[model samples]
Target: MIPQIRSRVLWIVMSGLVLLLASVHLMIGGLDQHEEKSQRLRFLPDGHFLRTASLGYRELTADVLWLQAIQVMGERKVSPEAGRWIYRLLDVVTTIDPKFTWAYEAGGIALCTLVVLPEESNRLLEKGMLHNPEEWKFPFLLSINYAFELGEDAKAAEAMALAAQLPGAPSNLGRLAANFFVSAKAPQQAIDLLSDLYEKTSDPGTKSLLGERLKRVAVERDLQLIEGSIARYRQSHGGLPSRLEDLTTSGILEKLPIEPYGGRYEYDPHSGTVRSSEISERMTLSMKRRRDSL
Candidate 1:
């Protein structure tokens, strides 16, 4: 009976030890995984430091760093801190190999869209533009970031204008740039862009389209000035103007604006609204585009 009790007690103690060891192993594994995930992209030094250490194998260094960057991107969750770290890694890669065009473009896009870090994204793209001036995609991408992400129409127009001037740029870039300028309330800039396009493009259809667009934007510009004067007149007189001429007669406008498209400005006294015979849908299109972007 004594031998039987001792055997049972030993079995129970051994089973408890085995279970305790398994639990400890699982706890250690969980702790290790958590620590590994918590580690962000701080494994690399900055760009300048890596450049000095590359030992003249700059391209090789860049390639290795790029692989690491992609690995982290695939594994980590999208976050601003992670985006910034990725930017740093790409910056190091570019520093080692300035001609790495895809790194600049891809890194910029990832930073902007995935992490919503515009400043870092633009910085990477600007570096690309600096290194590769002939690459129209950089400036085109800049236009997208500025127009849609940052909501800076003038900056977008400028970037898109540069893109349109480059070889192999899309044909619609010019029209889009003009629209951005007009959306920024710089109608003359739009008119100038369309005028430039008209002079350069040999296609008759495109030429005619540019001509019509230029005339329409000019009419819009004049309307903007006239309506502003009418609003001022209403504010001073406490009533709507009876005619378009009332604006100048009331000393609000220096002169009646001439319509650039051989069209006349029509004023509605009841609603105090102004329209042109050459009513361009540019403003409406621009408004819709802005709304869709939001």
Candidate 2:
């Protein structure tokens, strides 16, 4: 009986010890997993910190070192290389605080000025859009790039249209699009687009500018059509018209389209010239003044 009781006690103690050891092992495994996830979330994916460490500065934290590196790169103006550095820094900063608006703005501007390649700048803007697609400025930057730098009016128009669809985009963007279309030489389309914008907007400055642009586009379109008609008439009749009336009489034009800025089109019979009403004598005076100053 005494031997059986001792054996039972020993069995119970050993079982308790085995259960405690198993619990401790599971707890250690869980802690290790949590530590790994925390480490992964703390750093950016690009190995910038790893590179920094490889460069032999072990004392500073990764975030501070990254900021210092970005500032140095910015001061040097090395362009695309600087752009790459800034992008890496921004990635870390954004990962730290996804809602940081200023970081996005600064990152976008840095990408714009330093990248030197429109496609890369565009990719940066797209990344910003992923964070804040409803913001007006990202798409606006894309539109400006397409319109002014790339001279891709169709792409510019598409970007501007997307910007306009956003909640807070400036109303003037519509007028800008119309002007871009006109500058791209699609005047009728420009006229149609601006006419709609003019009706929608009531701001005095915007209205006046759109109205003027619309009139100018219409006049230029008419001038081109008339010029073509005049050329065809000359080909058929072997000479140019002596006056605006001659064109109407010969069925080359029904009536001369008056110049938009308040004057009749002037025709010089001797030189076969058509003069616009708003000729600036200022150019001659400006030249004289510059000569006098020199």
By lDDT, the best candidate is 1
1-294 per-residue lDDT for model 2 (tens digits): 999999998777666545533443343224334654223223334444333432332222334534443453345344454456556655654544444444554455445443434555566576677888887666766665564345577887777778778886667677666666666544465456557756865644335545654565566556566666677778988988766677788887888786777875666666665655653222113234545789
Name the candidate that leads on TM-score: 1
lDDT of 1 at 104: 79
Q: How does each model score on TM-score? A: 0.50, 0.40
For candidate 2, the lDDT comes to 0.55
- What shift in Å separates residue 39 of candidate 2 from its native position after superposition? 24
What is the C-alpha lDDT profile of model 1 across 106-135, one tens digit per residue?
676666544556668788989999999998
